[model samples]
Target: MKVPETALPDERPNTGARPVDYDAELRLHNRAFRHACAILARERVLDIGCGAGQTTRDAARAASAGSAMGIDTSSSMIARARELAAAEDVRNVRFELGDAQTHSFPPQGFDVAISRFGTMFFADPIAAFRNIRGALADDGRLIMMVWQALEANEWSLAIQGDRPQSSAAFSLADPSLAKKILDAAGFADATFQDVHEPVYYGDSVEAALAWIGQFQATREALRSLDAAAVERERTRLREAVAQHHRDDGVWFDSRAWIISARCR
Candidate 1:
């Protein structure tokens, strides 16, 4: 279904920018995502919608025989990726900043393209997938991870308290819709597997609340609300999180779908 444009990251001032904790997220989920990279053991890789280049570097390691390139629409994210790549002294990886729908790659640019929670924001799924297919080699594969459904994910549901009215915020929860769009884009062998995981927060409930306030879009949208509503939402979140805290810290059960397909 078509949705109206609203609250895009670029519209906000460094609001949607990737946070430092995103690296921690990658480190935590890398083991879970390794299977997505396994199929590309000896093939070149492309990471579309790459955020800070973590998975790109991982794919590079997985495909030691071929190079890896990461592309993202956000210039700041691409800049951070380049810096991280240099600091880590990682070779065989490159990054560029441009919209995936319009960006051009060299002929037979990649043998495999991958994304982790990165391909879902596209305004035009078919056009974006077509661009991705154009960038891949004949036998190339594509793998990605996306939220399974809104109700199945607590991480997203927990922070829904303060979210404002926006088309973009509520649009990414449909797996069947996404599968249909991908099929229409000429992708074949489309498959989705459900994976349940836990997303952790800090040792204190307050800290967890603060992290969500800073990073969660729904919370940010609430911040745009009057002070009373914001405080009420904050209180609600704290109470919700208190029930989930343990000796280790605050944690929430989350669910996602690992989507894989081939360019056809």
Candidate 2:
């Protein structure tokens, strides 16, 4: 299925024709986040922590008369994002490697800023957002998707069974705290919409296993186990993932928030 440039929250799944190598889990959230963005022509966009430029490219496509720039801390991810943009001939987008919290973005340069599960890792969210706010035009919008909480996401639980859930990914789980942070950072009217969707792992059990194994939590857990214990753990993980398998793919329920706010 060719993913639409924009979609409503209630739209049907559009991943049936996605490339096999695409990030399946992210594809689920992509639809909702892109829909919320609603990029417009001639509007400059900035994408924070844009992993591999998926969101940035989407924004660029929609903002055909404008331009989009993506920033991330990972050099490799930035490089890959550039490569993909070039390969796809998306000329209106660019990627940079930098930390959002301190990066000196052009003042009031962007009409919109966006993220996809990417705003949860700031060492200091208030400062980060303040900087972002400075980069936005007056009344500019911020649209982002963030995981609700570890307990609310089945994919994390299934993959890292029983492990103490501690990650930057869930930093913005509390709606009240998120609102407070945004308000303090010069944003107004922070609102959140609940998003419940099943994250796709892969088309088969083995494929899903390979993808899950690449997670830092899973790899760390396996490294701490002895060879025999590791094998047992792998077996356990396989069984857990298999439980969610369907004729089309492996999936797990997840909950997230699509938070939208405006620059004060």
Candidate 3:
């Protein structure tokens, strides 16, 4: 769930994958949120990089008595999120478009902060986390999921194909470095757990290609090549997906870090 080095709106291709790939996203990221929500009786929650507000809406349901706010840098995403919430008649949720890195979130405004496939793109992660930390109450909880190394994640490796790795997406892939960044950002009690999940690329090979081909990085990589070369690479991608195809869909082996920390 990483994006090319671009604005937040263009961060992801609107392949309608988020809703369809619920299993992948949940196994890799939301499992922690669900587990935490089950044990803790929370009142307020904040969801960052809350792509379509699904996670935000879920958290709002958990904090039914309180409220949940979803923030992202993409206005269109926020709009669609708002529409979804409205359609569901969910009143406890709200979505805003703003960069978490510099956004002045209300201080001590939330008891829990969550990010799924977000936070990796922050230009200055320490500053971003510090800002997020400030938005939490004392002893507040921070929960998020980050991708693992390139070698561990076959999904990205398949897409790479001699392409340069995305710096922003993989910036926090290393647990040690992620811990150091959190520590510097005034978060404590860092715990990183290994999570292996199946990421659904598409229902079929053609579907997968259509969705994956829209990735900004993919287009960038292919932009330099001629049609024949692009087709060759596309064929390679199709072949790679074939090996991982399943009865349900095209699933890629994925590895992520489920991180939990308390604001210091």
Tell me the tens digit of each residue's lDDT in model 2 across 1-264.
433322211223334433233345778778888999999989999999988899999999999999999999989899999999999999999999999999999999999999998899999999999999999999799999999989999888887777677667888989999999999999989899899988887787765766666666776776687878877777788799789989988889999999999988
On lDDT, the leading prediction is 2
lDDT (Cα, tens digit) per residue for candidate 3, span 183-232: 99889998887778767777666556655665678878777778788778
Q: What's the number of clashes in each of the models? A: 0, 1, 0
Q: For each candidate, what is the lDDT?
A: 0.71, 0.85, 0.78
Give TM-scores for every candidate, taking all chains together and pairing residue i with residue i. Answer: 0.83, 0.90, 0.88
Q: RMSD to native for every prediction?
A: 7.0, 7.6, 5.2
Model 1 residue-pair collision total: 0
How would you order the candidates by TM-score, starting with the best? 2, 3, 1
Give the candidate order by descending lDDT: 2, 3, 1
Pairs that collide in candidate 1 are: none
Better of 2 and 3 by lDDT: 2
- For candidate 1, the C-alpha RMSD (Å) to the true structure equals 7.0
List ranges where model 2 is wrong by over 4 Å. 1-22
